[model samples]
Target chain A: MLYIHHSICISPQFTFPEVNLEELVRSTDHKLYAKLIVNPDIPPAMLRRMGKAVKLAVSASGPLLKQYQNLEGIIVGTANGGMEDCIKFLNQIIQYEEGVLTPTNFVQSTPNAIAAQIGFLSKNKGYNITHVHRGLAFENALLDAFMQLDDNPGHTYLVAGIDEISDYNFNIEYLCGYIKKEPVDNVHLYESNTHGSIAGEGVAAFVVNNNQKGAFSCVKALKMLHSTDKDEVEQAFKQFLSENLSDNKTVDLLLSGENGDSRYLDYYRLMEAAVPGAAIGRYKHLSGEYQTSSAFAVWLADYVLRQQQIPELIVKQHSGGNTIRNIVLYTNYQGLQHSFILLSKS
Target chain B: MKVFVTGMGIITSIGDSVESNRKALMEGCCGIGMLKGFSTRYAETLLFGEVKFTNEELRNMAGVNERGVSRTSLLALHAFKQAVSSASLSHEVISDSKTALIVGNTVGGMCLTDELYKDANQRDTGSEYVASYDCGSVGIFLQQKFGMKGIINTINTACSSSANAIMYGTRLIRKGYAKRVIVGGTDSLAKFTINGFNSLHILSSAHCSPFDANRSGLNLGEGAAFLVLESEEVRDNKKVLAEVKGYANTNDAYHPSTLSDTGDGPLLAMTKALEQAGLAPADIDFVNTHGTATENNDEVESRAMISLFNNKVPAFASTKSNVGHTLGASGAVEAVYCILNLLHQEVYPSLNFNAPIAGTGLIPVREYSKAPLDHIMSNSFGFGGNCSSLIFSRV
Candidate 1:
């Protein structure tokens, strides 16, 4: 029952500086990369110390945090924490005989270094936990915050998720066949018949608490499944909806993790069919794919809850947004580890 | 929501199992010695509190046939197996339903990274080296070996990794996420960590004497420990060793390498943990301080303890002097030390403390003392200004 007091996202999509996302999507000039962050100043010393992901996470956390006085806990999630730093460290260590290795890069290569940095920058001396569970990384941290709020009320938790893609990342995904070969319009990602989704990077943060501050919807329930099939995923979705809703009715919005990957299309397709009356929306096209992209879906949910409007480009059916009281977000990594986070207007 | 510790296992330089570790602590035996586990290029100046077992011995005890397991994972598996055995949990039970494993290793498989590096570059490198360097492989191997389905997470928050893991385990039980969980951390000495600490000029040549006025720095050690936490519903004949009364994590958010000069983060974390445990600082009988013997760490931590206790601190000691600073495993390792203290009713000495600090006027207990200790507090602070404190009480 934690409330989302403030939230921010720095992704490839059009998210920052604009209150409405539809406007950003319309103003996009290119389609290859989609980082949503606005223009930011990068200090020279920071550039020497931080990679793109760390920079993005630190910036987002800094702005979104309002009550820095008694910041109770910090929970960070990343599919690959500091892979770029790790690559730099590894290449340097192997290239040079430990003589020219930069301790700065090597020190910040650990996954929790970003959280540590956030702690330092914010002067937050509260509980800090870092999670790296592939796709469920962000969801796990979010759930941890939810549980923390439930057990100890009136405390604010900083929940952040970040992941970045480098040439090494593209190489690994290229080897794993997760990168797209053919050019596809992100605006029309669902129309594609291809299997792989485009790779992207971003960081998102939320100041959440048990008390509903009315700026965002309250998260009703969250569930993570390992090795979920299409049928079982649909059944679980229905069970989740039933657990929350007294009326056997459709939700107002259904946010999805439909990356261009064909193996996982059936999961979203099942979701689309299950929620007949809801306005279905897919975001991986605008943001691309990372371990914690579901966090972007959360940002989207917050936006929809606040603005009470859905962009036509995002509307799959456009049937039930006049009374958009509920938004159910479904996210997973390659359809293996799935998460369901349900939120409603406060 | 009651979280009970049903079983505990450890593999430190002092011993290989919980019983042996307890006996050693009671007998006032120290395990810090000259480094012998791995060959070091900078050998003359380095000392460590290293376990005597080879990787093969740990792997054999852990029942892992795969050679891809890293030395850190080997230590983790060994301790995890011992925990299961100590708790009397059958393999069938673990394989049947959602048993989760929460491993907190700051440097996951750095030892493997060392091997991978030399094998690739040096022609004279040994042919026997074969292990994966990926950080997630440790958790993946444990999950595969044990056949667990519940939430498997790897926390990499430096020194507080395993303390956060135990905190997560308790939260999982209270949240009804899992009926049982194996929570702990493991770290092995590697060239990267050693060189990193050496570059920082914080590696002590001799055995570490934490909180000593003349202590220079800490001697790095390697080990692992895991505790089986059972939800109140599942506790059968398994006697509760101690209850995870409360825990809190706080970030200094001050500096990457240094804590705040005021020690506010550690103080806040300890206060929150005490509040969660429904106790005051006066209720804590003993504290397992994160006295890494480094000048900055000891002085700042002593200042924080004073602030928390309002000038009357509990009888606390730094066990790092005995086992060296185990890094990521230190928090969890010391936690087991706290539980051992609670059960044994005696406080271990801080070892090698001769004088008080110039400003804080704080002195740790120099020798073991017999006392009716019921509750113990343990602190672990890390590089990112991450500080965590846990309160464990005897059942």
Candidate 2:
């Protein structure tokens, strides 16, 4: 059994520990960058060298590490990691024509930098790894944590998903038709009849343990698939549910990765149909869309389960329950990689 | 719960196939030379272990006619196809939806750094190569081509990427998530990496000499390698190459680019791996060391080995001297080399080593010799203090 003890999210919404989730922030930028609540506890000397993504990751995980002890490992999932530093290094290479270049950008550009930074700050010297698969990145991290907890049975793990937006990367996605062409308020994200969804970036971290005491929720099951066939996805979903949940129990809430893009909305419809009795909710409108946006949904699910209430901003349809109990989070990337994660209140 | 290696395939600077790579290792052949496959401004200054194939030739070798396909993907496909064919895996088996594919890569399709520069500058209106920039693109291409329906993941932890990939695949099998997994790594030489290393001042101008007293730095290399790992039940009359006895991963939390002088991460990794395999220090017959020829790595690694083995270290060698450090592919490439050692009962020589480091006085295997070996260990340490070790025992 895997249980989540603590979580911290740095997203477009007010998701920090002190902020009220009921207050939503509206944005019209092409890219919805995360508003991080800087933690003054971190020394200024250490904060001076970190990039935006690194700072967000370290700050978000800092409080959790303090609250929890004996972290056995750190696992991170990122699609585009340290993009600011990567672009800086690339620009220097172009400007100098391969002459002398600074090493700071090169040093911090790797995808594992965030994980390594967290490990260094926490002083935990156990297993550390970074997963970079497009959509399945976070699911892979979660699954690895689950397996590790299963094997050890009592150790705590730190799992996180982080990504940053750079103007260069956002422009590339815009040109490739991955972001909305026209600027729209993020509150009206799903209402636009557009070809692409709004671009967003954020970081989310969780402290996971095998024990359920003082935990917000327990992870029941997690599954990932690379196929796009509807029948195959449905079969995998049914098999996963049967293997994890009892047949008599039904999911209380279903969170779908339904962006405003018409091209990929049918897949969400298919998933919603699979669990017809559950209340439907959407998170992209609040968090925007990224490869690892499912992580934000996970944080949201944990919050809802702990608070025993669903915020109106995220509720797409009310069907089965007045109180949150069991939740399923489903997300896919460009109709290629699909993920399903089940969570229940503790 | 035993996991076995059913098949292995590789393409590196020394050779293109497993047989050729083994032959080159036995014959003490070095593949480091001036860069010829790709044009770079540093072509005349720095040496590299290029794969000796142009992008066009590699595309033809991989039977890929796609215009925008990167060299990284082509190299990966070539090795992947060889591994699948060598294992006699049928199309039905590959598309079974239970076989996972886990790949590690640092420079995915960004090998076309110049094209990316142009595209980023808006000089071109979304080039076809733009889609191949992310690290997941290579794995996605392989999954699409092979029609793989199972779990697919990509890892990038600098040089230790593929070692962790192998470890992750084993865990998935042990946990009953997948019956079989295709695990490996691929990286192609690119200016992005070359310039990055150059800025760090760790790129050697000559062929690297691992563990030598007067070693300068590391030479960047590129290639791909894959191993087919299957559960014991799925082995099903297949010839088992070797058993993945034990594995462990640890972080130094020391520095972003260098290991500590005490070598805490490497020591812990090797010790934990040995403990997992239910073996002692004396049981390991040979070791494939992560000797990158840098001033800091060779000494740190030597100290770690001496500490773990209590000054009675086993015979060891560094293949980086022969093929240069292949970065992300170095881990799996070295793992394949370890497997070959167990299969042939031979220890390959470490070329370009004349003397040991001054402090630890550790000497690598200087000559190729045939020996009856039962178990071997491989070490891979990456930037950001990521350290991993794998033990393979003869079945």
Candidate 3:
């Protein structure tokens, strides 16, 4: 019932809105920073006060919100929200020795600030929420929207996953071995047995509803898991696929987030073995890795299904089939956080 | 499908357990005073609803030996264990795939903003707390503790965070994704929030007076509360504290941090919740309100109540007057308090209130008294115009 009528993303890959998708650019700065996309409608004063994450989220979802007025709700997901503004406020507190300070940065520092700003912009005023969990944040938010759609038929929702890279989060993640020790060629992401990934910023948004008119793709199922045990995961994966697929057959494509982390290669191998006949595709190499990188994979699923062809750059091991229909995107983080999403060509 | 509250646990500035909090409520004792648990520049200048437990002590209470986790997680664990034990839920039952955990929190490990600041600026390997900096750390910490396999997520919509968590929990059960859910929220008083609220100029130097004509602002507090809610089919002959009758979440969409002057969001939330419960304003016996005592909140909430009840506003009180506005934890915490009202057929008085606000002229219950109650409403409105209301009725 969850159909994507319109979708767009702002990432290191490109700003794909009303415009066409662009070729991927590999990460060279150890971090793939999103190219800041600006909207002319946003007042310059408001833009001046917005933090990096707020700006990215508004720029990505604002157009959709403006085009389609009075959407029922807005659900946003983020791992580290407004770390840039938060750090600014913290630095001020330290610099001023707990003296008088401005509230703008602190007001915009909460994880829900992105959704709040969007709420102010759209003024729809129905139901609004933000999910701040790490790996499953987007899935949770999407499920909330789907739950609403199921409750009230034919309701439109704006769902998004956003994360902005800042010096604070990037440096800490780099030191913690989640990011590559040094800048590596993202083009050769999986070629070497490296221990870490190249981090990136991403905001993927969709205008979704149950009406299905002019819809490009549909998300049939979503399952989140916390266990890393192979048997448990395999069993869950089998159950997820069997329950979601009408034909109970192999999916057309499996766009996985195997972000070239050598430590979790075995987990990816286990995943590939679970689905034998599916065409394997990879996206983290193009978009870089993040907490909600699976969002980008979902966005790509809609595109591949609409175009009925897989982009060769993203194809790791392509099947001979030319027509793409069912896509199952699997995303894993440190082998601890994992999710499976079943998306179908409309 | 009826969602029944099977068990509850709470740790607030007033008390640590259900019985203790109930006793404090009966005595009309307030939990807000000078800050003690966490130190800040406003420590002596402003009042807070501190939980009266140090991090090390809370760790001991929670039976946690981990250091990387924040105080927020420890408070959550303290309440979570109590809820599980009170419900007599075994480890096997809790770890079942049908049992879900949906928690709401605001200041996760950021309560340790100082430590995070140090770790982020480091040149060498990051501290162990790097992974725990985000809001997910609290839920992830409790998830690992129980080995919970069901849908686990953290919600953060500012002050109404946990009320939305409870509402979402009901949706999951209705959708058949879960049979039972442990839903609640936890927030620790931290320099991060204190400074944040202080910067907003909403932190009251004196005690907050809900519904008072000369009310100032809110006192930032710290606490945690949780409810173990189960579908009726899973009742299995368990004692039901109350039935979750109705709930609604709405946004004013007028501003980021302030509710509109007309109480548009509050009115919608309360009206919709009553509609879902299939009740009228007259059916509500009492209301645990989200009266933050700020100039905007008190007047707006009062106006909303007057409009919804047709000027015969039900007996209402803000628990924030007892425990300073707990922010993210207030929704779930006040929910536990409302369940208390339902169970005992009594109402708690607002701690600090005198005359009603000038325009609205709404007066809160000033004395803890026994009342025949059927349905009790709890309201939680947060920053970002996120407002939610939940109703609990006699089973």
Model 3 chain B worst lDDT run, 10 consecutive residues: B119-128
Instruction: Give lDDT tens digits, candidate 3, residues B1-395.
Output: 99999998999988989899999998998889998765678899999988988888888887788768788888899889888888888998888989999988998888887878787777586777888878898898988888999999899999999999999998898889899999999998888788888988889999999889988899988899999999999979999999999999889888878899988899999999999899999999999999999999989999999999999999999889888988888899999999999999999899778888887888999998999999999999988899999999988
Those runs of model 2 whose alpha carbons end farther than 4 Å from true positions after fitting are none
**Candidate 3 clashing pairs?**
none
lDDT of 1 by residue, B67-177 (tens): 567888888887888888888878876654456778888666567655555543433323343323545556766776876657777777788888888998888988888
Q: What tens-digit string does per-residue lDDT give for candidate 1 at A236-298?
A: 788878887778555889998888777788888888888887888877776778888888888
> Per-model C-alpha lDDT, please?
0.78, 0.88, 0.87
In candidate 2 chain B, where is summed lDDT lowest over 10 consecutive residues?
Answer: B116-125
Kindly indicate the candidate among 1 and 2 with the higher TM-score. 2
Higher-ranked by lDDT: 1 or 2: 2
Clashes of each: 16, 0, 0
Question: What tens digits encode model 2's per-residue C-alpha lDDT throughout B309-373?
Answer: 99999999999988888888888899899999999999999878888888789999999999989
Q: What is the TM-score of each candidate against the true structure?
A: 0.88, 0.98, 0.98
What is the lDDT for B143 in model 1? 71
Please give, for residues A1-346, the per-residue lDDT of candidate 3 as tens digits. 6999988888887556543444767677777888787867899998998888899899988789878896988899888778888888887877787789988888888888888888888876788899988889998988998899998887899999988888888877787788877558788778768888988888889999888778889998899988868778778888888888867556889888898999888777777777787899998877788887777888889888988888778888878777777899888877777899999877
- What proportion of the true contacts does each candidate reproduce? 0.44, 0.66, 0.77
